[model samples]
Target: MRQFPLEMHHMAPGRVVEWRLRSTAGAQSPGPDGADGTADRRASFNQDKHFTVAEESRAADDPTASWIAVTFEVAGPLDEDALTGSLLAFVRRHEVLRCEFRRLAGELACAPIPAAELALDTVPVADFDRTEELTRFLVERFKRSIDTLSWPLFTMGAVLREDSATVYLAFDHIVCDGMSMPIVVQEVERGYEALRRGELPDPAPAPSYLDFAEEQRSRYLSIDEHDERLGYWKEFMASGDGEFFPRFPLELGVEPGRMYSIVNEASPLLDAAEAEVFEKACLAVDGKPFMGVLAAVAVCLREAGGPGVYRGFMPVSERGRAGWGNSVGWFVNTMPIEFDASPGRDFEQVMASVRAGFGEMIGHLDVPFVRAWELLAPREFAARSWPYPVNFFSYIDMRKCPGAERHEDWRPTSHVWSAQANGACSWFQRDAEGLHMNSIYSDTPAARRTMDGFLEALRETVREIARHGSFRRPIALTPPRRPALTPLDVAAFARRG
Candidate 1:
């Protein structure tokens, strides 16, 4: 480990005394007395500590880059000292924050480090005009690779402005998910507030991530109890046509040397009144905002693919269990949502089908996608095909979360790393402001066109819903008819022409 001499510099207003942080020694278990003479804290390293199958697959596919970033904008005079103390407290409360991963006997093992060893970095904001510089800094931060075997799987830093600052907590997806972000932020805020009042932050609720991990391992190892659920998935996979669902047809051929990139398209913000109407419409149909957005996607897919089954993946949280709601870890599992888009069916029918499919999937959510794939499909087939692109929909109402709304002004933003191999993925989040959607696809003209069309279709679907005020009845539609050409037919025609 590298050592550095202690140094002091002029402390900024309301700033904590800076400490020279030295790297901890190798992954050896700490002694009875921590480096600072504090009592040693150790978490067992076991097979249960290994990453989830989804996380393991993601890491194996792309280990060097991070796509998840949680940025918070805070307005008012900042207190660096209080913030540092709060962050340390927050880390100590969540074992996953102090945990790192290492390869042991052909498997990954987690090692927990003392929270005292973690440090926060503060970068001064020279001027408000340095927007480009700040963007570059954040981009570089997200692009930097995480050393899984190290003590920290995440990084925390602040871009300090005179009266306001932006605090960023970026992490590799392997350690956290979207649901975990708000919890982390809320805890940090509470910790900061407690420290500001010269009080120690309260202990986190029972059932930490380690506890959840053990429960997950136990459930996964004993599959006999979940035989019915497993059978349902196996049958579902087998019932599908031999061919995978079709990708959106691209007009132009992909360039030989083209690189992978993400293209994002979002609908205009729905104002308070407009959002109200949309919410009412959703409730009228026994659906939530997520169902509304998903219904729109289903409509678009029906229009794009035509008279066939459409398959996509949705990530559901397992935090509803007792003592698990507030736990910070990747307690999310991906489940398949299949909708049969018959040409004769109307929008209402399509939505009803979607709602029913979603309900059934949730009922059987205990079976992890990894295990389903292993039991239902061949290894070669799983490796060669990207069967389930994700459709992520979340509603984050900060008003309900304590401490989150205390700031004069704050906004949350997220980004995911994109790769060509991953294919197309869509995410939707509805907050107080409005609805925001981000879609990632390959950086090709054809890909862009397909995405643009899909967004247009989604907007049209939402407008129709609002116009009708309820999804109880089918919207206007023309007589059912087949497309002039399938994607394959179009490709053949393109080659011949």
Candidate 2:
């Protein structure tokens, strides 16, 4: 599924109802001793959560609340009661959904409610008459309602109609990421079907995200910047101008330390047939499809006057082991990477660089990103947003995800929303139809022009690779004029030769 803005989606008119989590015991603050009528078993915030809370804490009523959402359809009318049961069962299946973030002793803590006491109330909001009005309403509701400081950090709703219904759910980034979208759809659908049959959905027990966070802290919490495991990160920062975050080479017209509204766009790059051919071409060069795509992106940037040495960070999945794949939470580790995209390099050579760069990055995943930021850039770490524009790239192949086979009928789509940004992030998703690139960047005249040109070049470069087994950087037919050389300069050059 492609990750795009929710406003771009077509909303059908129907009765809008929300299934929000309810509890008899409301949010409970910790006692003087850090106990809330229960055992002191609260899990410390993971690396991602630490960074998120720090950013949000910088400003009160921050508009850019981090959230990822999903929308899908169920055919042949809507079952209100069955759907309510499914929503409840789905939330209970994932322990993270039962969690609420609160401050205990000046630090963020996650406390989960008991499953037995958990309840879902289906509150009817409104019946939108037009899809246009409905779209606006959902966007505003999602932006205003899902706050990280609150207990119920997620919202679920369904649009009822005679022939079909559209279901959508949004969660704070503290509880979910892009990968969790498909799993949410699969579990909700399965639970709904089984409930309709008057039976229980006997899926495997999902591991708790709180447990995963605890394990992560046990392994990485003690390490500091002096630890030898951070040698890779140290060297990476040293390689640059001593900047922890790499800047996008192109100008984005964003002022330093200022955040602007985001412009979200998604477009197709190639169809299934062309994607297959592109994959075959990548295989011919002994590289994976992702590597090929990265190579193309690097080459495109260089051709657009970017530095020949590409430097950026990619979100590497921490769900490398069993049981954690099905568990929902932010299982991402941001790792830095750089590869040579110098002049005169062919696509195959760039792919080799990408392969080596990727391999080297994974070897040093022991250090968490939040720790590195705190050590390397303490001032910026304390801010609400990134210091400047940072280049970010993410890729996902949805064909391998659960419930992908029914994507044609379900028409599932994932969406991401943020109130503001200081940089550009491009996510490439491969589904059944084709390979598509979804981008969210600052809304500025310069940013729009730069990204437009970059996307155009990237599309052609990949298509050329698919057409042939290899691709070479196109050279200008007429080289620009050189400066006139003085007698002394010519002599110096001749003597060096």
Predicted structure 2: clash tally: 0
- Cα lDDT tens digits, model 1, 1-497, are 00000011011222212222233554455444544454433222222232433345466774323346665555566688887777666767776666655555554545556555555554443332444454554566556634344446676766665675556676665567677777777777777778888898866543567666656655664564247777657545555554233333333234443335555333343544566677787777777766776766665666675335656667777778657677677777767677765666655666677788888888888776655554555442345234433233333443344344542244444455533533566666655544655555666666665666666556656766766754334433332332221111111211231
Off by over 4 Å in 2: 26-62, 203-205, 472-497
Q: Per-residue lDDT for 244 in model 2?
A: 90
The C-alpha lDDT values of all candidates are: 0.54, 0.78
Candidate 1: residue pairs that collide: 67-417
Kindly provide the TM-score of model 1 when superposed on the true structure, using C-alpha atoms: 0.76
How well does candidate 1 score on lDDT at residue 95?
A: 68
> Candidate 1, residue 322: CA error in Å?
2.8
